[model samples]
Target: MINSSPGTSQTRSITQTSISQTRSFTTVSLIEMWERFGYYGMAALLVLFMIDKIGFADDHANLTWGAFTALVFSAPSIGGWIGDKVLGARRTMIAGAIVLACGYLMLALPVDTLGFMYASLGVIVVGNGLFKSNAANLVRRIFEGDDARIDSAFTIYYMAVNIGSTFSMLATPWIKDHWGWHAAFAVCCGGMLLGLLNFALLRRSLAHVGSAPDDEPLRGSRVFAVIAGSLALAASTVFILQHKQVAVACVYAAGVAILAIFGFMLKTCDRSERAGLIAALILTLQVILFFVFYQQMSTSLTLFALRNVDPAFSIGGIALFTWSAAQFQALNPIWIMVLSPLLAFVYARQARRGRDMPVAAKYALGFVVVAIGFFVFGLSGRYAVEGRVSSWFMVAGYGLYSFGELLVSGLGLAMIARYVPARMGGFMMGAFFVATGVSQYLGSVVANFARMPAGNLDAAQSLPLYTHLFFGLGWLAAGGAVVAIALLPLLGKLSRAHQQATQAASRRESLAPAPISLNAKNV
Candidate 1:
């Protein structure tokens, strides 16, 4: 018979603690899903709306979109810093959600002026910075220590992200088609509010996860000072983007300087520190390329769909496939939902067989898939002839890209934690964000080139230009894959010390006496 003494009560308490922690994680995952719904919903329409409604040229819309998205990546570094060193994760997330809500509201204003969009994007970027990293960090806190479950947990969490995107993708574009972009923007605002409400409801359960480190609270009055400095910088950026030539130059320069700091700071570290940072840098660069390819969802691909993709379909006598170009954005998340689970199972089975795929291998595979996708796009462009190619081709490419995302893009944050030391984990996470920021800028450059008029070519003859661009993108992805494969041997070298450390941990675990049950220990 099971013991029913005071000791048993103590064991029950420990079990309860674990149960509550798991539930809190579930709450966090739900909130993250809702937050993604809001963000991706807005993103689906942001560029097209800027071009069509705001009357910017395609080039201008693409550049501004890139800049705004780059800033979104940049804010995470600052947000991670603040969450770790000042406001704590929970409070920072609270502040971020509030700011995000306000930003969306600003976008909803009927005027739709330049200032409103800039200010609104700024709020969203800064807010995302504060909230995004903290939410991931809190997930880490849910588990007591590094273990295999964390991997599975992240996979489950990532599924939630795509699942959330699925609903928003379907809804946002439909709303924009019938009610206009304002209604679409408002829907995202409502999604943001829902995330906030979810967070508030779960606060009691999540208290242990998001508190800032004991040593990291904001210095007296410094919080206000940091806020002011960030605001000034944002205002300056808005002024800068107004100048066409300077925007690209400025983003590149800023990206280099930020990364150099990370590089230099890592160099000064102890061996473990240096190794972890190296791993982080590699992970970060891979992610940068991941986003660069991913961001096309809003720019070249959207335009491609608008101009060339034939969408002749009828769904139960209702016309389908003639939806706005932005509506194609919904397809990505839907694919992710279908693909991620299958991929996760494959990965788990490999791990169980002691042949687990390395992060680098997955990243390399992703680039290869991206290259193939781009090649397909080029083929589609070549055959488009009179007008848009079949929408099914774009769908096929997006499907491949979505699978590539499951392999790398969605695996990033988890990989960072696995590789980095606990002390500087957040900083390394920031470094990952910085890499993505650079990629966003680079993607803009690529998009700008794609939109540029080819010499001696009339508007009627621009198909070759797009074909060449797609071919170029395919080459870039292929080149990246080659380089990444060449560098594969180096990951093992870099991870050697980590492997040794893990082995040491395993030895200690084997030799040490088993931990007493909580009941006996308490008694």
Candidate 2:
């Protein structure tokens, strides 16, 4: 046995080694940061640009935005396929970054037509699909077989997302205020280009990470075929983006198909692994619901910030300065930057003390926290003097939403690694996004219900709609959290089943595996 007191130098070295993660982790995180910077910046401005600048009907814009974001999440499944089976992760990612840059450039061109906007969105969607999942997949690969470290690493990687989002959400709106919409889109274009350049610079650090697949090398004629096929697929996405009905159908179909596949895979796993998969699926459903609420930060909530929120100051007498509805979106990412590391420490401390929050409880807590945010948000509308409420209401809601985000989406990555089979890593990561994809659609559905008359936020009829719709959603989400918490025992049992199955397999291997090693050469 080896034992050392905390004061000893040996203890200090062990601590250093524990704290230091892979070099690839940081580089990939930087890639993610810049990618999110463009994505969220565009996202924060998209709806407002449609309604305010392009004159799209509110209903039309919301549906379009929802469908576009849904595809953004869903497209990753195919992207993961290309990464895992066609081009290597790194190459696919680089190609995607280029596409992303092109997409943003399209947006920056100042074509005020709906068709052009949809085309730009489709290009970004396909680009995001290719880039997003492959990057996360690389992170997962780096920490393979080490469950203990995977959670913290994924948490850190998820942090990169908010860090970038915070800056973009804050900066893009300000850019739009000063330089106009085209300039804002140009900023998004510049962000993606920065990401691509960073990835190239840091390519050497990631060589051992997302390398080309051994069996699926890009060579000669095959490369041409892949390129042509990708182009065709990209064209199809543009067509779908222009057609709302078709895009909605595809999103629903993808969601159902993914669920069916995950269910079949779960049935095939051994008893131990089966439990974790089942728990993961259940938790994923809850996560979908959480995103249904989260997605509103850009849509309905943005509307609220514009019409109902007082941008001059908060309820607590703190000064508030939001020049545009889009600028308000920055608050969520800012809160996330503050909250993620703190929550990670709480979870790490819990684990160190031989106690960990059960998967279901964590899910429950996330839902509850978000529910409370919505609850407060809903109340803000009621307490408003005349038509305006304190900006503090939205800020506080964002703070809570940020905490829940870390608990659910941040920890959800770790949950996937813990619960699912290694062979299914790429598929499962894609499947996780499928859940998010569906949530985007669902969020749109909910936001659509709160839609006021087009360009009529100041209308008397619009005020009640925002207040009551949010209040209803808050209660509904809180109730859902309560139901989830009650089912904690079941989720915990499934988690234990995974452990038991692994133990049973180990016992069988230990007892019967010795004889299997007595091959002719050994004998």
Candidate 3:
């Protein structure tokens, strides 16, 4: 056999590495897709389910969802740390998936009691806390050191979320209509099971990647401890969800705690790390604002669809198809899927040319479009027929909102990857989710501004309440855009400092002498 030249061998090696990377990323994406399928499937119907079945009033339902979601998002902070320190990211993710599947199965049980529902939600909260950040950290690890690839990869990864959500959001509502609520929840359980199976089949694709713990054999004692702690946490979550006052207190406390964590990190980190942490903190605040807008899709917007927006897709006088109100939530993910590739292409191209827009600037631009989207929602009222706006308006508004999301929330994780150090990646990712969780609770509070008054209000009576809220949200987004723009110069300075410090550190590493080997062969 003829020996290959170095050049040919190098090229072949690179090709194989690329293929492995692709396979690993694809496995993670598909798993995340299915997780989203189950989560969004349940989310699409949860508020409505509470209102109709549990007899929760409008405000109560909105706040309860908000509180539950806040806890759901916040749980990731501890989970991410666990992934980094206690369990391997890969193992933690697998465990979380299993827990989530069990949670959905609980919802599938034929119980409509308040206690049962709250317990089911608590289980989901625990699972999400464990699953969300570790899964994201895995993707970050897969493309470590390549900032350009990180952004593009996360954007595509985000598209996976929408892909799962779009199908579930549409299907679950239809399933609820055709079969019943519990049957629909069972479908969500089935999706998670499918995800777990898919992950198992391709698990070896990730064999070469994970946290420090992955290299160590798992201890039975550690596993037992984690399980016991998780059960306690799950029970606490049930109590938290049941008590709105406690949730409010927890949200505020968490908000303050995150700020303190950032301040402490900034104070303690090396010069090389300080600027990056500052940049991340600023960007994290922007993400919080963006998610507030996001929260409306499930709370205020879905309720608006239920009351004021016509649910039929039509052209002239021809009706195409009619969707239930909850199904309209699918529009956000649908538009996300449509926009993700286009944005990813643009990001990759810009990165190649070294002309990519700064993340802060993107946030400003995101808020501008988010404002426009809300304005579209507000304006839809102008042409309403007997207080019912055409479904096309929702489509148009969601498209714009989704575009803004691409700019802001879609890049949020990429921002963490770009700025935060690899060692801090898992925990900071959790912190970012904590910020989003706080905003989710705040968003629900915001949704209450248009909470329907008790009694059966006609569509005409309800129309103005939503329109007024939409217009106010538009202005809030506009203000956010202004603030983001105002911070760009500061962000630019910080970004430069971070880059320079990073390069200087890299030079130190490269120029340093190699360690002397003490082995017998070397001696």
Candidate 4:
């Protein structure tokens, strides 16, 4: 009674394949959501906690945060190698979740000493290094060879980040107000634990995927080695965070090292891989510029909200509930959650129509919007009443900023997945993150340009400082846009070469003769 036609069988196979991929993607996305929840919950309060409780001056706080985050981002380079070669991506990711939970728990303790804080941050940097790149690599693996779906999938995956961050960014600040900061940090720890549990329950979905090591039995010696190495990295992180000059030197060194690494890869890789790497490098530089603007959400923008922006939403003489200054950080994720789906839809549609835009072109448009968003922020000063802009202005500016983020930062990982060969995917992904980390530190340094003079400065005195910085940033972004546009012709040519090489390689593989069995000859 069952039909056995090739068409019917092929349709069923496709359906099953789709279901399996969806389940795997969902499992990874959910864990990522929880991880981000823990991370953002802590992030929303970190700088303010340093300033208000630790008594750091604005410059010291900004630079310190920059250094800490730089280390956090840079650690992934080593982690990606570990995931690809030593332990399986799945196992490494789980270990990272455990380490991150412990780090958050440390912060929840009542110890407010600088040493304790630095140690806590060090642990987090190690854990993030292990977790971030591997999680992204898994997503890339799940959709390998499917270029169109990769873009849409990553955009939705990005939504997972916003979903987690939005809740924690809003909730952590409120918890700090009521239960105290330690309690808020405890909630972050709880979020990580929850993510680990969620992953445990659904991990079978990824049983067939991951690096070569995933297929092998567990090795205790490997686990021990990884743990020992992680400890050393964590200690070094503590030292780095404590020394501003050392951190700066390390960041610059990393920047140079990444460029050299790219050059080496281009020189050594086959002709097929060269074009893609070149495209990746050019796009990566654009990402560095974008993150400088992105870092404002946590640093200067948060400080702006604290000093120069009205906290309450209002309309036509009607009053709404007010938010804590820290909670304004939630706006970026809120807009991201709203916009990710729309952008993903457009990408999917364009891909299906065979009219997909180049990622390079997307980067150009992203900077255009980013420039506009900063301009909005800069111009908001013109409308300030008593040196405070309406909350609506923040909403509008964040909307435009978040859109640019989708086009550039959201697609950053996808760029790696598309261009890098599968053999080097993990390491290259790590390198991309390293680039972003370097930029994160740079962004913090840029934030210092708006650093206020000591003393109780009111909103009126601080407003101009932030607006001037915003104007300068807007102009910088406009320049970035112009440069991106100028490079489009080159990027387009490289993209075509990469695509032709890929197709040629695929054809060669498909046309190769099947191996002859010795048994057939014996018969």
Which candidate gets the maximum lDDT versus the true structure? 3
- 1-523, model 4: which lDDT tens digit per residue? 9769999999999899889999999999999999999999999999999998888988888888888888888888889989999998888888888999999999999999999999999999989999999999999999999998999999999999899999999999999999999999999999999999999899999998799998889899998999899999999988988888889999999999789879988998998999999999999999999999998888999999999999999999697878888899899999999999999999999999999999999999999999999999999999999999988889999999999999999999999999999988888889999999999999999999999997878898999999999999999999999999999999999999999999999999999999877796667
**What TM-score, over all chains together, does every model reach?**
0.88, 0.90, 0.98, 0.98
- Tens digits of per-residue lDDT for model 1 on 1-523? 8768898899998789779877988888888898888888888888888877888877888888888777777777777777777777667767777777777877777767888777778778777777787777777667635445556667778888888888987799889888888888888889989988987887788866765553364565866865786677567657656775676676777668667866776877655456656766776777777787787888888877766666664546666756567778777888888887887787777777877777788889988998898888888865674755766777788888887877777788778777765555555566677667778867876876668452434433656656677788889889888978887888867767666765676687899997878796689
Ranking by lDDT: 3, 4, 2, 1
Off by over 4 Å in 3: 1-7
Cα lDDT computed for each candidate against the true fold: 0.75, 0.80, 0.94, 0.93
Model 4 ranges with Cα > 4 A deviation: 1-3, 517-523
lDDT of 3 by residue, 179-275 (tens): 9999999999999999999998999999998999988999998899889988998898888888888999999999998998899788878978999
Residue clash pairs of candidate 2: none
User: For all the candidates, what are their Cα RMSDs to the real structure?
Assistant: 4.6, 3.9, 1.2, 1.2
